[model samples]
Target: MIKVSVLYPNSDELIFDKEYYLNTHVPLVSKLLGDSLKNAQVDFGLASGVPGEAAMYVVMTHMSFESLESFQAIFEPNSVEILSDIANFTNCQPQLQISEIQI
Candidate 1:
């Protein structure tokens, strides 16, 4: 399996609407991606390892796919529409990474 990680960095100046992301945005993604998306998990960061440290990312939405082709097929066609939805939820720019599952 392969995983696509969408990481949103935490920022004092940025605004993220958790309610809209979870309720509206995520569902929209699932609907658009369709069956190509095997599964998905959304992580909400609370803190770092330290007692008083900020989390590197406020949100990480990890999506699983059977293969890169499956991911690309959906992502390539709908990237514009899907990506544009970000502005409705958060102001922070997201970092994206695609990784193979070693374990």
Candidate 2:
């Protein structure tokens, strides 16, 4: 399986709309991606390993797919709409990573 991680790094100046992300953005992505998306998980970071450090990211979304081709087929087509929705939620530019999921 392939796992795609969308990470929103945390910073002192960052603004993240967790409510919209959980309620609106996630569903929008799920609806757009359809069956090609095997599973989706969202994480809200609370803190870093260090006691007083802020969490690395404010939010991270993990998506599982059968293959990169399958993910791209839907993502590439609907990316415009999906990306545009970000402005309605947060101003943070998300970081992305793709990896192979083992077991």
- Candidate number achieving the greatest TM-score relative to the actual structure: 2
| Sequence-dependent TM-score of model 2 | 0.97
Candidate 1 Cα deviation (angstroms), residue 57? 0.5
Instruction: Write model 1 residue lDDT over 1-103, tens digit each, in one string.
Output: 9999999999889899999999999999999999989999999999999989999899999999999888998999899988999999888889999999878
Worst lDDT window (10 residues) for model 2?
Answer: 11-20
TM-score of each prediction: 0.96, 0.97
Residues 1-103 of candidate 2 have per-residue lDDT tens digits of 9999999999888888888888899999999999999999998999999998989999989999999999899899999999999989888899999999998
Q: How well does model 1 score by local distance difference test?
A: 0.94
lDDT of 2 at 26: 96
The C-alpha stretches of model 1 lying farther than 4 A from their native spots are none
Residue pairs that clash (backbone atoms under 3 angstroms), model 1: none
The candidate that wins on lDDT is 1
